[model samples]
Target: MSLLSKIAEIEAEMARTQKNKATNYHLGLLKAKLAKLKQQLISGSSGKGGGGGTDGFDVTKTGDARVGLVGFPSVGKSTLLNKLTGTYSEVAAYEFTTLTCVPGVFKYKGAKIQLLDLPGIIEGAKDGKGRGRQVIGVARTCSLILIVLDVMKPLTHKRIIEKEVEGFGIRLNKKPPNITITKKDKGGIIITTTQPLKKIDDETIKSICHEYRISNAQIQIRCQATADDLIDVIEGNRVYVPCIYVLNKIDQITIEELDILSKCPHYVPISAHHEWNLDGLIEKIWQYLDLVRIYTKPKGQIPDYNAPVILKSAETRVEHFCLRIHKTLLAQFKHALVWGKSVKHNPQKVGKEHVLQDEDVVQIIKR
Candidate 1:
């Protein structure tokens, strides 16, 4: 049978199977088989006219961070890009208006954020339908994703879009599972867990592993994860990204409806054409980006507040700061004098290994 046919058969079987302790192992095996077939389909190993390469857009990465605008056609993605970055993306009332990826840049909190207006993706995007792979390929490179949805449309569109993205190995607003698997030479499957396993059992884990052709290995579970989580860990190619659901055309909705929509987490309501609640969107973007702004101070001179060195929150060390300024700065640097919440006292002498906080001022002392 064809890979797609095989995949469909397994899916059908999985759907037919009842969910209970008696069927967990069988369901896990089916999931593993489905994941393997999908991977093969994506890589074009199925030999059924699948493209081996991702025909992604040829957009150069610029600025300190990148964000992507993704959604169905004519859902204000183009409008959002144009208004936010003052870049034209050919807005229209018809579907599939933006054919290619349109990139725009804007500065916020001393950091330049690059936003890409991607082509609208339809259902079955994960299976390479409607420029889906190309759009998702660009989205995978983004630091954050803005899923633009029309408030007038059914909210079911959100779930459909999310499923499409997830099928392409993108885990939106999720963390990696705290499960670890190590392959061993001859030992049998060794299972260890720091916490109790409630969602998945030992047999199901083994069944999934066996389907993946893993025989001798040690598995460690640190969290209460489900069968899907175990499968994700086995696949090992998932990308966990932050996503914001941009509910556009809120101007057409009633005030009471808007209030109800506002209660949803990670959702921002706005009228892209009217420029409503845009400041709130920007604020939320800044918060999710988790950027650090470090000011440079020359010896016996005031800190330069006009421009600050921007760094990601995870890479806010003094060494990273120096590298951002200049590669040679680290070679000549002895230490840094930091003045911020990161330091106990103002203007504390610290080494290059010291981590910096947002809006911190620093003076470098040469060796």
Candidate 2:
């Protein structure tokens, strides 16, 4: 039988199989097998495999960060893209109008953020139905995801989109679980944890590792994680990203309905056509990206506020800032004077290893 057909069969068996302590190990093994098959299908390694990619939908990733817009058909994603970035993405009153990825640039706080308007994905998208896997493939590369939805449609659409993305190993609004696995050549499988594991058990872990053929490995799980999270680390293709639900077309809904949607966790209600509540959305994006802006002050002149060197929080160091400006600066650099929250006193002299903060003013003094 074909891989897809076998996958269907396994899924049917899993659905038929009831959950109990006696069947947990079997269920875990089946889940691992299902994940492996899905991974193969996504990597284009199985029979009748063509889905698992963006093909021509791949756009050049520019700017500081890339945010992808994903949702169902006719959810006003293209309209939102046009309103936010002033880029013309064809918009119509029908479904599937956007058949590919549309790229746009949104400049906020002197940062050029790349916004991608992906084609609306349907229910069985991760299984290669329509352009679902390809569309999700683009999303996996995004720094953040904006799950756009229509307030006029059933809210269940949100759940379906979440499932499709999750199936493709995209963890939305979640951080990578604090789990570590170290493989060994001689030692047998050893498990250690500082805290109790609620979602995953030792037996489940052993079953998953057995399915992956990991015979000798040391596993350390620090937090309460699920079998899926452990499998994600084992598979090593998962993308953990923050997501903001952009509930669109609020103008078509009542005030009470808008209030309800606004209260939903991680969601921002807006009218993309009317450009309502968009500033809040932009602010949320900036907050989630966790970017730090450093203003460069010349030795004798004031700092220019029009443009600031943007750096991610993890790489916001004096040396990193200099490297971003010019590679030669690091070789010729002597010290940097910082005037921000990162330093103790005003204009403190610091070395290349000094970390920077948001809106920090820096002056590089060469030897």
Candidate 3:
């Protein structure tokens, strides 16, 4: 049997199985097995090598961040791409208009964001059906996913798209579960937790470990997690990414429908064809990207506001900023004077370890 077929069988069995005290261990084992099989599918254990860049769908990543437009066909994705980035992607009233990945640049707030218009994905995408795997594979490398939806179509399409993305090991708008596992040679499975785990028990963990052939390991759980989250850690290929639901074609909907959609979490309703609410979409993208911009000033000179060095929020240290400019800057740097939200006093001198904040002004003094 094929791996996908085996996965389908396991899923069917899992669906029929009852989830109770007596069946938790069994369900955990099944999930572990299913996860293993999906890994095989992605790795191309069947000799096809999975969905590599052979399909020409994976484009070169550029700019500060990449946002992929994903949805079913005729969902105004191409129209939005054209309006947002001023790039031409073929739009049609038919299904499957976009055949490959179309690249565009979205310049916003002095940040050059790469916008990727990917081909429409169908059901059973994770199973290598219709270019869905290739489309989703490209999405995995993006910093953010713009799940475009048609307001005229049924909202159920959102759930289907989400399921397909999840099947490919992409966790949308979620953080990695607070769980860690360490392998040891002699120590038996030692489970520890900072707080009570309500979703999983010791028996289920043991069963999952045994299924994965992990005899000795240290397990730590810090928050509520399910069997799937545990399996995600064990399998280790999952990507947790933030997503925005872009409900397109709001011009056709009534004001009541627009109000309803506005209340939904992480969603922005817009009419791509009419070019309505495009600024709102761009602003939301900027907020979700969590990027920091630092303006550079020479000694005894004003800060350059025209061009700014952009960095991720996590790595905004003085050393990181130097490394971003040039590798040699780190060795030549003595100290940096910062004037902005990152510093208490204006133009305060700081070291390499000093953290930087958004819109901070920096001046590096050479050693």
> Candidate 1: lDDT over CA atoms?
0.89
Which lDDT tens digits does candidate 1 get at residues 1-367? 9876887798799889999888888887888888888888766632225653434377999999999999999899999999999998998899999888899999998889999999998998887677887888889899999999999883888999998898788999999999999999979789999988877889888888888889999999999898889989999988998999999999999999999999999999999999999999999999888888999999999999988999988899999999999999999998889999999999899999999999999999998
TM-score, candidate 3, is 0.96
lDDT values, one for every candidate: 0.89, 0.89, 0.89
RMSD of each: 2.2, 2.2, 1.8
Report the lDDT tens digits of candidate 3 across residue range 1-367: 9887899999999999998878888888898998888888877722255644446674888998999999998898898889888899998999998988999997887889999998998988888887887888889999999999988874789999998999889999999988899999978899999878887899899889998999999999987889999999888889989999999888888999899989999999998888899999999999999999999998777889988999999899999999989999998998999999988999899999999999999999998
Compute the lDDT of residue 9 as modeled in candidate 1: 92
| Residue-by-residue lDDT tens digits, candidate 2, 1-367 | 8767878889999999998777877888888999999888888732245654455686999998999999998999999999999999999999899887999999999999999999999998888788887799899999899999888774799899998999899998888888999999978789999998766789999989999999999999998877778888999988989999988888888898787778878889888889999999999999988889999999799998899999988899899999989999999999999999999999899999999999999999999
Which of candidates 2 and 3 is the stronger one according to TM-score?
Answer: 3
True-structure lDDT of candidate 2: 0.89
lDDT of 3: 0.89
